[model samples]
Target: MNISSLKLDSSNTVLVTGGAGFIGSNLCESLLSNGNTVICLDNFATGKRENIAGFASNNNFTLIEGDIRDLNTCKKACSNVDYVLHQAALGSVPRSINDPITSNDVNVSGFLNMLVGARDANVKRFVYAASSSTYGDSTNMPKVEEIIGKPLSPYAITKYVNELYADIFSNTYGLETIGLRYFNVFGRKQDPNGAYAAVIPKFVMQLMSHESPTINGDGSFSRDFTYIDNVIQMNIRAIASNNKDAINTVYNVAYGERTDLKQLVELLKKYLSEFDSKIKNVETIYGPQRTGDVPHSLASISKAKKLLGYNPEYNIESGLKEAISWYWKNLK
Candidate 1:
């Protein structure tokens, strides 16, 4: 059985909020793959059960249809869970602009509930999803954790608030918590049909359908698109890191590189056309600039490197190649 290794105590449970969503599902799969018992909580607001479909039959996995905003739900999910990976949140800057209240309720209020729940249950470590949007209006090329700018969108505000609250909780309650400020993470299981869908998946789906994808604002906008495996690796290392300096702190989880939207489009078109030659000449449609999008994003992983030994294994080109292939096989 692939269920008795990895130094995991079979009785020690791990809970992942939003575990049915893209990143959460991937994290759950990796933990289960390494012989850990996992409890996954999701309201399916933006998550899909199909994302975690492959784990349904695994005896070590349990799925709970619940929202993180509910104190009772968080309490129940936290029971006996040794570690908490909080990934539940409503993302997208435009979506937050349109409905800041709901975003606040989930991203802020929901995060507090998980913090309280994890604290009450005495979880060994609480690792949650923080976002690059926190870098906000900063002009710095490679964003470091110590420096940040004013939030430009409701989404950015909410994610930054998560780190702030985590700091408060750790100081006041002595709960060991770590936040990974992920920069443009993308990979398999990322939903492609939503209006607020992320760029990589949306582009892959559109290219697969022979439809044109849109590159907002001259295709010059750049991001440090990290693959999901690297993100999962950060979570593992964040919890497992023995460095006293690493605990109860946040680190930038990214590839320490930048790729423009136009370049990304070219890469997508190039890789996808390999699956179908018809996709070769599919031109992209550029529209008015998106509302809260920062022009460029690059992260400095030096702190994570020194503290957590986090060496990202995939760069954007390699990651996009794998992501495109997955969408071609599964979504086409």
Candidate 2:
């Protein structure tokens, strides 16, 4: 759980919007551990209170129960903040497809509110969670930042719009920003029992409960699965980097390797079998691939390495071992 970052050690105060969600809470936890004052702004709409329950006793941690959709709330959260990590958005491509209106209102409108608030507060840096979904249907293997295809879903559209907004804010308002295009991020504190739960956690929970997990699309679909701690590294690097060229641009935050659903399932079963041998015999059911899903996905981390000095330490196996251990002790 130890973390290190320059220029973000103790003198800075960071505003982590959506700080109760999986990624945001991890950011808050790392920042507080490093002696930085952490302000967690979340509405608990999608972010659960239990995710941040341990921090309630920490003196350096402050929780602001609010929504990003409200301009006043964004401004209030941004007040006197040295940095802004804008992570408040309705994630999931399927969710956005089901309710694009709500997604747009929260992702686009709320993002603009935070940008305006950050600009007014004169925050030093704004690092926000972008998505690999921005690549859309480019048919490109190893998606680069500059090259992106048209969006495949409503959620992809919203995230693409976020990059657009961030670029404009940097140009028009002079607000420094960095966008991290996360690819299948999974690890500890991630929700395992939601309607739109991510694949890894959801599979773990299901397999532990002796239920067969349904893999959409013959288990051939692949993703550049990234661990949460790597994501944390990228966020901190994005905040602390001094390179002017790194600012106002988006970087792929990933492990730079592709993992198919079948390989992922085998690894999960192998890991979970250590906890319960019955899990090894659990069967996987194949289902129709859902809408708005790409056949394959991966990322290019060269930009992040050269620009932000980002070095992801955990690959899928190492990360899953750590994550499964936590879930075994905590959830099981």
Candidate 3:
């Protein structure tokens, strides 16, 4: 989907929290390219400064080095901003399991601070990152918006809390909000080096170096792997859509197709092999399933398509091919 053609007002100032992270940095670049003033607020905890360095020189780009856990920082970032894309939160289920307190402090408390700041500032709309983990334990083949199960981890709880808070803020304070329940998003600029790095990027890096990529289970675990461009398109649509019914609700931002871990590795190797054939021979190791890991997750993107007019441009194979090219050039 070509989001640049959307009717978003380029004259407005948009605030993207965690703007130095993978997803946030992409949004910042897209927004800036579309001629919008962008203020990026990040503390550099998990977000790297280099991610935003490319566009920092752009006149329309501004960086506010601050933490969202601090209400004052959140308020300052929101001041004079026309829209808020809140993406600053600690990710990874295992990381949350190890440090639940810190995760809650940032994801839950920090989210509330942003909402309050946006509400007080009278921003036109508050679009934030929600998670597919909110579908925890639900065995539904294709997870929908209305049906959800108990959170499987502290991280899941934090994301679900975001939806609840967004709903309440819209009802009580009259803040127009949209929560995007992102599936397993992966693409360029996604971190490939971290103890809690996502599966796709991490595996890509490992395979590039001819290291054995380990699977948590027997490689049957599946996820609705989404590409970053689709996610960016969804965020833009959320801000651009004037549809009243779409304002205060959440929609699953995904490709609506599940890819198993085995299939995922095969695809990654297939693409990376084009750059270095040795990657094709790299063996994979299997490990016990990690705690809080959902056996399978798939999203029904009908809500996003029907309401927001979402049209995901790339599926797993195509997105992986593009991602492999980036990793080969950048990380090789």
Candidate 4:
């Protein structure tokens, strides 16, 4: 979380695709804080303009209303950019299942456009937001970067394809890229209103309203719920690292631990009750397990630790405390 420790160049101009969404917006803020010039390109399909609205007056910030699916837009955004933090993608398994065409068009095609743009522009490093969904049906305890199973859903296929495209781009065009396979990232600014909203923020919103949040299954499904700040750290490290071995490879960005839905809701109730004691009385309901959902997911950040020097500052308990406080203050 120490921006100074990252040793990022203030003079560098970075382009953050999907800069109005949760993780992308956070990256924009962090890069701007370090006195770097930031160009944000987003179609606002899922990203909100208000997320980056605060930067309107900051001279260092620039917003380009465009989608990554368009090669021209990607090329324009990549113009004179030192680095490209590609976060633009249509995310969600059920959403993809509901409509695979749009998902593939955006996640896969859009990714390809950006890769081509970055390659043509000769960007220094192309860091991307890869997904843990790439682990798919794998039952691995501590998901390593190299060991991956077949993708389970259309969304997973798109993300896995992203890694393949990144690898190919690195090899074919000599464009340096690093893919951070994020595991269940959650924190402030994360949207909780959508039908496919992530569990933690969605649960927090429901609990804050005293509504009984429904669990997908008997509540045993687990994930390596990562914090947004930790994710930001890994991205910056990817940019700052001079290690040749780290470039052109993917690394798992996680806290190296897992928490089941049962324990997760308990922790949510525990944290939210600190703001409103009545939250203790709220309940939860069980439902059929969601399709394409793995029973368990954990990560081994050893590769990141060894190469990028990744050290996560927040665990599940600590991360939930911070995230809940933000939701309590901001929740409508």
Mind giving the per-residue lDDT tens digits that candidate 4 earns over 205-265?
Answer: 8998899999999998899999999999999999999999999999999999999999999
Give the C-alpha lDDT of model 1. 0.90
In angstroms, the error of model 3 at 2 is 4.3
Q: Per-residue lDDT tens digits of candidate 2, residues 159-224? A: 999999999999998999999999999999999987899999999999999999999989999999
Clashes of each: 0, 0, 0, 0
Model 3, range 78-125, lDDT digits (tens) per residue? Answer: 999999999999999999999999999999999999999999999999
Better of 1 and 2 by TM-score: 2
Instruction: Write down the worst ten-residue block by lDDT for model 3.
Output: 1-10
Error of 3 at 39 (Å): 0.4
TM, every model: 0.97, 0.98, 0.99, 0.99
RMSD value for candidate 4: 0.7
RMSD to the native, candidate 2?
Answer: 0.9
Evaluation by TM-score, superior candidate among 1 and 3: 3
**C-alpha lDDT of all candidate models, in order:** 0.90, 0.93, 0.94, 0.93
- State candidate 2's TM-score: 0.98
**Candidate 3 residue pairs in backbone clash:** none
* Candidate 2 lDDT for residue 70: 92
